[model samples]
Target: MQTLNTLRSDARAIFDAALRAADPRLAVERVLARRGNHLLLNEIPIFDFTRGKLTVIGAGKAGAPMAQAVEAIVKPDDYLGAVNVKYGHLARHHAGVISNSARDGVRAPTKFILLYEAGHPLPDENTLRFTHSLLSLLEEQTENDLVLCLFSGGGSALMEYLVNGITLADLRVFTNELLRCGATIYEINTLRKHISQVKGGQIARLAQPARVVSLVLSDVLGSPLDVIASGPTAPDSSTFADCIAIVEKYHLRETFPPSIVAHYERGARGEIVETPKADDPLFARVTNVIIADNKIACDAAEREAQQRGYAVQVVSTTLQGEARELGHDIAARIKHAPTRTCVLGGGEPTVTIRGSGKGGRAQELTLAAAIEIEGDAELVVMSAGTDGTDGPTDAAGALADNTTVVRARALGMDAHTFLENNDAYHFFAALNDLIITGPTNTNVNDLMIALR
Candidate 1:
C-alpha cells in the first residue's frame, strides 16, 4: 500500500494536472490553431471569417486567459474587449488597460473598458456595472462586425445585469437563497435569464446583424450551449414561464422580487419579449463550439495516474448531486477498489446550506469523505474547483486522508456537525487541509480523486 503522504501528494498532483489540461489558454489555442477564424461545426470549419472586423466580447473566470490565447492568433486591431476575470490573468498585450502600466506595444482600447471585479457566487455592484458595459458594447455592434465570444464557468455571476424593474440588491438576496437551497446551475441560470437583460439570448438579439462565434470552455456537466453562461450568445430554449415554474417549484415565489414575478407574468401573457428560440434568425450566422470540458480534465488525471504507476479508473466525468452524499459514494467505491488504484470523478455538486457555516461544495465533499473513510489502506481523497476557487473562499478546496477522522476526533471536533453546519472551510482549515492555488484562470467545474 502507498503511504498516506504519498497518496496525498499523488491526489494533489492529479488534481493539478487535470486543471492544467482544462486550462482556457491551452484549449483555446488548440481549437483556434486547428480552425483559424473559421467556426468549426462538428470538427468541420463551416463559417470562415477570412475578411471581417473581429470583435472579442465575453465574461467568465477564464475570460482573460481565453482572450489572451485568441489575441495571440488574431491581430491586435481585431480585438475588442472582455471583462470579469480575476486580477492579473490577462496577457501582457492587454495588461495596459487593466494594469497600472503598459506592455507588449499593445495599447488597451480607450473605448473598451472592464468595469470591475465583483464577488463570486454572488453578484454585487461591480457585477451590475460590468454587465451594463457589456450590453452597451453589444448595442454598438453593426451588421459588418464579427463577434468572438469566449465563455466559461462563473460567467453567470460575473455578467450580472438585471432587467429594468429588478435591482442588484434583489438579485443578491435571491441568489443567496437559491444557492443555500442547493439549486442546480441549470435552474439558477433559468431564473437568472428571466431577470437579466443580457442573458438568455438577449445578447444574441442585441448583436442581431453581427455574426457571432462562441468559443466555450465547458464547466457544466454536459456542454449545453444554451446553459453555459446562461447562453448569452446561443439561443435560449427556456422562457420566463420556465423561470416562474422553477421559482414556484422551489417555493421561492414569495421570496423573489415583485419585479421578477411581474416580468415573468407579463412574459407568460406575451406582453414581454421572450428569449430567442433555436430557429430564430438571430442565430443564422451564430456558431458555438465546446473547446474543452470536464472529460478533458478527467482524462488528463487518468493519464497522470498511469504515468505515476497507479491503476486508474475514471468513475465519471458527469458526477453531480448533493456534496455529502457524493462523498460517501466515492469513499465506498475507494474502499472496494484495489490498494494501488486511483478513482476519479469530475463535475460540480450542490450544497444546501442549512447551517451558517462557511464552505463550498468541494470543501464539503472532502470533509464528508474524511468522515466515511477509515482504514490503513492509505486512502487520500481530495476535491477542488478547476477554477482554483471553491465558492467564495480563498482555498481551491480541501484534502483529507483515512486518518482525517482520527485527527478530527483528537481535536475534539465532530465531522457530522461540521458537515451539517456547511462549515467545511473551518473544518478543513483547522486541520490544515485546505488547498490554495490562487486564481488558476481556468474553470471546468470540480474534480475529485481518491487514491488508495
Candidate 2:
C-alpha cells in the first residue's frame, strides 16, 4: 500500500498532467482535425466559404491559438480580418501586427493584434478602446462575408464596451464592488450584459445577414453558451429583469448605475430591446460549437490517476457553490477514503468576500481543506483554474498536505483569520505552495482532486 505522502504527490502529478493535456491550442487543433476544417453543429457547417469570402473576428484569451489553428485550415486568400487575443499568447509569426501595444488596429484584415495587456479580473480603459475597435471591425463586414468567431474565456473582460449613457468609470466601480462583494461569474456577467454594447447576443445581432460560426472553448460551469464570455456571439436566455433581480438580491441598488437603472426600467416596459432568445431569427444563420470543456480536463485527470495505479472516482464535473465549504467537504471525504483512492471534481466555485485579504477561489478552497484535513491520512488536495490564473494573483492555485496547517500555525498564521480577511494568496505564497503557471492559454473554469 502506498503511503499518504506518496498518494498525495501522485494526485498532484496527475492533476498537473491533466491540465497540460487539455491545452486550448492542442484541443483546437485536435477538434478541428477530427471534424475537419469545417465544423458542423446541428447539421450546419460553421463555415462554408466555397462561395463567399471567409473572415475571422474574435476576442478572448485563447483567441490567438484558435486563430492559428483556423489559419492552418483556411486558404490565405479566404482568410480576412483580425482576431483580438490576450497578450503573450500570440504566435511568433503573427506577433508582428500587434506587439502588446495599448492601441487598437485600424488596418483592414489585420492578422495579429495584441490590442492591450490590461489587468485581469477587471477591465480598464485599454480594454474598452480595443473592444470598440473590435466592434468596428464587425461593422465593416458585408453580407458577402462569413465571420469565424473564436470565443473563449476571459473575453468578457477583454471586450468590455459600455452601452450609451454609461461611463467606463461606472463600470469599473460596479465591477470592483461586485468582486469585493463575492459575486459569482454568472451574476457578474448578467450585470455586464445589461450594461454592455457587445454582450448578450448583441454581437450576433450586429453580424446579422452575415453568417457567423462561433468556435467556443467553454470556461463556465455547465458550459452554458449565454454565460461564457457573456455569450457575445450567442443568444441570451437571461433578460434585463434577471440583471435587475440579481442586483437587488445582492443589495447593490445603491451602487447600481442610474443609466443601467433606466435601461432596465425601459426594457421592463418593452420600450427597449431585449437580448435574442433561443428561437430568435438572428441565430438562424449562426452556429456555436463547444470545442472543449471541463469534462475533457477531468477525464484526462482520471486517466492519469488510473494509469498511476490509483482508484479514481470523478465526484462531479459541474460542482458549484462556496469554495471553502466545498473544500471542507472534499477533505472530509478524502479522510475516510482507503489508500490510493483519488477523488476528482471540476467546475467553478463562488467566493463571498467578507475579508479584505487578497485570495482567489482556488486559494480559498486549498486553505479551507488544509484546516479540515489532519493526521497522516496523507490527504492531499489540489484546486486550480484551468487558465493558470486565479483571481488577481499570479498563482494558478494552491496545494496542501496535512503539514500545511501546522506550518501556518508555526508562522503565527491563523487559517480562520486568513480566510476571514480573504488573504489566501499571502498565506499560500509564504508556504511556497502556490501553483504559478502564468497563462496556460486555456480557460475551463476550475479543477480539484483529493488523494487519500
Candidate 3:
C-alpha cells in the first residue's frame, strides 16, 4: 500500500502530466500544418502562404504560448498579429517571438505584432483599448487577408469592446451580479454575448471579407465554442430573450446595472441590433475549432495514474455545480476507491461568495473535503485550477490529507466555520495546504485529483 506522502506525490505527478499533455504548444502544432504554399488547419487549407498576408490576433490565458507557436511556424515578414493576455502571462514574451535581451528582459516586439496584457475574470480599461485595436486591425483587412485567431480561457474578460451606450462602471456592476448569482459559464456568457460588440460572432463579422480561422483552447465544459470566451468568432445561439430570462432567474434586476438591463430589453424588443446568430452571413468565411479542452487533461491524468500502478477510475470530465457541497460528494467517491487506486476528474466548479473570503473554488472545495475525510491516515486529495490561480487568491487550490482535520483543530480552526464563511483560503493557508503554482500561462479550467 502507498503511504500518505506517496499518494500526495502520485496525485501531483498525475496533474503535472495532465498539464503537459494538454500543452497549448502541442495543441496548436497538431491543428496547424504548413504545406508547400498553403497553411493547413487539420488538413483543410485555410491560408495561402504565397498570396495574402496573415493577421493573427488572440486574447486569453494561453495567448502568449499559442502566439509563440504560430510565430515558430509562420514567416515573420508576412504575418501581422497581436494578442491580449492577463498580466504576467506575457511578461517574458509577447505576440511576435520571445527572446531575451541583453538586459535580461523580454526584447521589444516587432512592428508587425503587438502583445498587450490586461485583466482577467474581469476586464479593466486596458481591455477596452486592446479589443478596439484588434477590431481595427481585423476590420481593416481586405478580402485577400487571412486572420488567424488563437483563443483560450480568460479571453472573455481580457478582450472586451463595450457597446456605445454602456458605461464601464455599469458593465462592472452587471458582471459582479452574474458572478455572485451562481450562474454557469454558459449563462454568464449568454448575457455577455448580447452586451458586447466583439463577442458572439462579432469578430467574424468584423473580419467579414477576410478568411478567418480560430484555434481555441476551451475552458468551458463540453468544449462549446460559443461559450468559450463568449464565442467572439463563433455563432451565438443565445438571444436577448435568454439574457433577460437569466437576469430574471437570478433576481438580478434590482442590483444588476440598469444600463445592462435596458440594453437587453432594447435588444429583445428589436430596437437594438442583436448578436449574430447561426444563420448569419458573417460565418461564411469563418472556421472555429477547439484544439484542447478539459477532457484532454482528465484523460492524461488517468493515463499517468495507470502508469504509476494505481487502479484508475475516470469518474467524470465535466463536473459542475456548487463548490463546497460537491466537495463532500467527491470526498465520498474518494472514500470508496480501493486502496492503491487513483481517481481523476476535470471541470469548472462555482463558489457562491456569500462571505468575504479570500479563496477560489479549488480551495473552497478542498476545505469541504477535509471535513469528510478527517481521520484516515493514507488518503490524500487535491483540487486545483489548471490555470494555477484560483479566484483572486494566490492558491491554485488546496490539498487535504487524512490528518488535515486534526491539524486544523489543533490550530483552533474549525473547518466547518471557515467553509460556511467561504474563507477556504485562510483555512488552507493556516494548515499550510494551499497549492500555489501562479499563472500557468494556460487555462483549460479546473482539475481535481484524489488518491486512496
User: Scored by CA lDDT, what does every candidate get?
Assistant: 0.79, 0.77, 0.83
Per-residue lDDT of model 1, residues 1-452, tens digit only: 45778888999999888877887877887767435566543466544466545566777888767766765655334446656654444433343465431111122322243323555778777677666665666665667677778888888888877778888888888888788777888898888888877788777787767878888888888988888988888888888778778888888878877777788889888888887889888888888889899999999999999999889878888989999989998888898898788989998999888898998999999998988886546788999998888987998899999999789878998888999999999988999999998778788889999989
Query: Could you tell me which 10 consecutive residues in candidate 3 have the lowest summed lDDT?
Result: 101-110
List residue ranges in candidate 1 displaced over 4 A.
33-51, 86-116
Candidate number with the higher lDDT (1 or 3): 3
Q: lDDT order of candidates, best first?
A: 3, 1, 2
Candidate 3: which stretches are off by over 4 Å? 91-112
* Cα lDDT of model 3 by residue, 294-327, tens digit: 9888888998999999898777889999988778
Cα shift from native, residue 188, model 1 (Å): 0.6
What TM-score would every model get versus the actual structure?
Answer: 0.91, 0.91, 0.95
Clash number by candidate, in order? 0, 2, 0
> Which candidate number maximizes lDDT?
3
When summed lDDT is taken over every stretch of 10 residues in candidate 1, the lowest stretch is 101-110
